[model samples]
Target: MADDFTPRYGEVEQMAPGIRRVLARNAGAFTYYGTGTYIVGNGAVAVIDPGPDDADHVHAIRAALEGERVSHILVTHTHYDHSPAAVPLKAATGAEIVGCAPLVLDDNGPRADAGFDRDYSPDRVLTDGDVVAGSDWTIEAVATPGHTSNHLCFAYREGEALFTGDHVMGWSTTVVSPPDGDMADYMRSLEKLLERDERIYYPTHGAPVDNPRRLVRGMLTHRKQREYQIVALLKEGVKHIPDMVARMYVGLDPRLTGGAGRSVLAHLVDLKERGQVRETDGEWRLCATSARD
Candidate 1:
């Protein structure tokens, strides 16, 4: 709502050894403003998640470089706030834009205010274990499909830090809105991060998480809690996706209600896939055929 909420919401900060973060400014409904982007290595710098297509923001990145060339533009995901600007930035700097292909939007279509659309696409698609070479730093891609199927995190191969696109963040739990978002896949991605001994997390939108291990644990626990709450609500006869969403997300902001429903649907779909719930003629209830352990 405010004119150019970026300057007020974003901040540029240093992470570790060879990393710098550009934090987004505002905490808009869908945008994780003040999130950090890393500048890895030296002479040949690589900018991660260029944020939005704001002229000033791009200028700021260029200014920070102070004439240093940006060899590669790496994106964590296809969300507009994170990747849309890659096209312009690539045209300007001639940096090879890299990211995974956009995720397939679910049947319900995208949330009204969602930043990205199904039409969004990346220049070069990356998969798990792929590496992007830079002058000073080499980044290894880690496919973390949960927030969206296209989510990718990059770990600096030199043990410097991990660039967590939206897979994880310091300010909040990354939303798993369906049809693109998957709760099960998101948890697996979190578990994958837990298996690593990385030191820091350079998120796309917020501050660098100093204690990534602890944050990962907290995120996992939080999602588990949500799942428990949903399961409990189901026991109370809250049938159908919309009904469950109404009761489970009673006090959430109106704007986020749809996103919350998408998350709830993802959880329900996961439960159903595991034979925990059943949808018959548009109604959702505990699957009568499943055995209770």
Candidate 2:
């Protein structure tokens, strides 16, 4: 994602042969430069991620897609910034809201459904190997549930471009907040992508990822390093999550402190589940077997 990007907020930019991208005006800490709504195909198109429920964004999509039939409104996940506009876009174009299932949780919490788009109601929930088509393009669903349980990456069969929505990103490593986000499942999902042959990855957040497998390998290594750092911190009597976060993230933005805590908690939870660490009261410590290992 080192590529240069000039944010022409509502203009449609042609990315590749049959792919175009529109930038929503919702930039922030989490969203590097806001959500990138991708429009695939020419005549009858499939719009992936209609973006935030901004009226302007929806109108931009409708305007850009004027005279073109919207075959499908595909959402990768139900994040607030990614799925809300599907409602209005579908109403405007009468497109089928196809993709991930709606936000379903056994229960909810601040950390559980943080940044979720609960209003996301899918017309059809696509599973792995499910395909949706336009006139000249086809999208195959790649079920990658990590950033969120319902997260799906759509693969364009016309070209080997994978629309990786938050599962794998360019600007930064994905945050695996727990109760919904799982580090174990996230790691498994990353390894699963290694088996694929998608040449370029167009993440919803930032710039497109070229040579994506290389980035995936590095992401795996980075996560493993985080694991080691957490274990080392535990060995040094850092029993609290906040202390671990301070030691692990030296210059993290204060605004992202809560997310950092959630991330550390995710690692601890994964470790505890695997018997590598044990939680006592509100503290965490390495298991004897893991210490030996």
Candidate 3:
């Protein structure tokens, strides 16, 4: 199950029949082994998530092309580590950028990663069921907004494999920051994937998910458990996100607590919308009827 867990920067490894993965150099807490830039098909190929704007990474992608024509540069979302390289790749290959629109965050919600590629406007905006066909590959876009409002998962029709983006990754659960990310939408999106018959998922980060259903179900269960814990803590008079994070995520790395707090806020927002919880002056509490019900 461990495939390229310790990924080397700029290494192009063949994954499936027509899919090859190029690990980007940018590795961190968020991006497990950097970003996995997938190249699908041969002769005429489609690149998925071109990754960061690193010159060496872009050169690696160009070299991986091996003179093969790049018909499409498909992006999952506009996270800094995921989409910025598309610009340079497109400039080099004359490939049209295809995928979700750039994310727009509201000022009222939890703070989001300001480093996202704000200028990432796809040549063609893909809806839930839109299809992008190449000479050898046909990808169907599945709009899966949660990690970001415009997040997309592309299904490689010929291989029955899903390029899941950050919608579902095997390494860790997706971070659902608010305004840009919606927990309700995230849960619904998870349910949406359950209807698909794809056997495998190639997420932007981490190794491939062979048991997609099980992994996705586990993700849902984990989210539900966190939500339950938050609700229970609310009943105990835990009023703010920081307090909730401190109590719920005990022994968590101090640096990650900020991200965890945002996740808790996302859950609270969802609960508040569902009438299960209420927030006043940034203080959260369990609803009386909801607690009884």
What are the per-residue Cα lDDT tens digits for candidate 1 across 1-293?
Answer: 34544443344556666777665443566554543556787888888887666666776676677777888888887665776567667777888877677654434633433457454466678899998886667899999998888889999978558888888878666778776788999999999999988888877766668899999999889888887877777777777777777787788777777777778878888888888987778777776654242
- Could you give candidate 3's per-residue lDDT for residues 131-192 as a string of tens digits? 99888999999999988888999999999999999999998888888777889999999999
The residue-by-residue lDDT of candidate 2 on 90-191, one tens digit each, is 888889999998885542333322567867888899999999987799999999987778889999998899999989998887777778888888999999
Please give me the total number of clashing residue pairs in predicted model 3: 0
Q: Give one clash count per candidate, in the order shown.
A: 12, 0, 0
Pairs of colliding residues, candidate 2: none
Give Cα-based local distance difference scores for all models: 0.74, 0.88, 0.87
Model 2 per-residue lDDT at 195? 99
* Candidate No. with top TM-score: 2
How good is model 2 by TM-score?
0.95
| Model 1 regions lying over 4 Å from their true place | 1-12, 23-27, 102-123, 289-293
